[model samples]
Target chain A: MKFTILINEGPYQHQAADSAYQFAKAALEKGHEIFRVFFYNDAVNNATRLAIPPQDDRNITVQWAELAEQNNLDMVVCIAAAQRRGMLDDDERDRQGKDASNIHPAFRISGLGQLVEGGIQSDRLITFGD
Target chain B: MAMLHIVNKSVFERGTLDSCLKSSLSGSSILFIEDAVVSAVNNTAVSDKIKAELSSKNFYVLTPDLNARGFTDADLIEGIKGVDYAGFVDLVADNSNVQSWL
Candidate 1:
């Protein structure tokens, strides 16, 4: 089966990010194809590389990056939401005249069009949010 | 087509479960995850309502979320089933589409 994931909340503060990650990993382990993982609303925070979780706790951001790298997943952060929350990739940072880019390399900032495309292209679009 | 309706909020905290139950059609699958697992317990305020709907729609709760909340499968309502992350994936794959009640 082909699936798309939609995450709407940030890491640590909510369980949505962790649950989405677990679901995505389980799906991939089951031999299902993940079309894309779309980060919307506060979920764009998951792509920020600056978050440093406690040593005893799970680093949700790194978990996502590693999962995406292992599965060759398309992790897209919504450009509008990313802009609202000040999440920036190198290109977006340059475009917005920002001094630094915080977005993790595993995630690329894109538009809602990619989300719609994922919904259309996949068999299921599962959302994990608050 | 049978849709998979996922609820991630607690019924005690939000009306998401109520709205999902009301809007979901018969034959659909309802999977409670995260805080929503609290609703799957046998003797809550909303238990009767959920029990009544059991015959109409399938009900499931995520096991890890329940365990995180210090709940066990024995705490689940008679008709509701508990599933792990792999089962969660199967639910999505088996259903026609997913409607997450946030």
Candidate 2:
């Protein structure tokens, strides 16, 4: 079974981000293919390199990065959501002439079409968020 | 025909989830998002067979929903599966019909 994650809650806000992490790791253990991980709405915050979680709590930004590294999953941030949240990629950063690009590797800005596709290509499509 | 069934409510609030999926006609995707993912792992009022039929039709359950709820794929209810945004796009691309069940 191929797996895909649609995270709607931002990483810092709540359990949505962490829950996605646990599921991704489990899918791999089950021998299921992790096709992609999509962050939408506020959940796109997980892809932003600028997030700074308190040292007391979990480092969700880094956690997501580690999850991507372990699973080799495609972490996608909805372009619309990212822009709304002001998470600009290198190209967008350059175009906007921003000083730095905070987006991490293994994550890219994409469109909602990816959500529709996740439903079609896989044997099943699972979604997470509030 | 397929529907992207989104249980976006924070928690499994009574009949909201059942209402969400039941309200949707057949051949639709039921995504338990946010706190909705708990619906997939919890003991559902609906029968397992019915849920299985839903998945057999290729109805999808997005994975991140489960994760957000602190669940992993192994903890998912029987017959429920996961799909990311890319795969989600493929779902809409493959199927010509999509009605969002909120």
Q: State which candidate has the highest lDDT.
A: 1
The DockQ scores of all candidates, in the order shown, are: 0.94, 0.10
How well is each residue in A11-38 modelled by candidate 1, as lDDT tens digits?
9999899999999999999999999999
Model 2, position B8, has a per-residue lDDT of 53
On DockQ, the leading prediction is 1
Instruction: State the lDDT of candidate 1 residue by residue for B1-102, as single tens digits.
Output: 699999988899999999999999999999999999999999888899999999999999999999999999999999899999999999998888899998
How well does candidate 1 match the true structure in TM-score terms?
0.97
Q: Considering the two chains of model 1, state its CAPRI-style docking category.
A: high
Model 1 ranges with Cα > 4 A deviation: none
Candidate 1 chain A weakest ten by summed lDDT: A121-130
DockQ of 1: 0.94
Per-residue alpha-carbon lDDT of model 2 for A1-130, expressed as tens digits?
Answer: 6656677787756766775676677667656787888888888778777767688988887887887787677888898888877888898789878887878766888899988787677665655665
**Candidate 2 chain B: 10-residue stretch with minimal lDDT:** B93-102
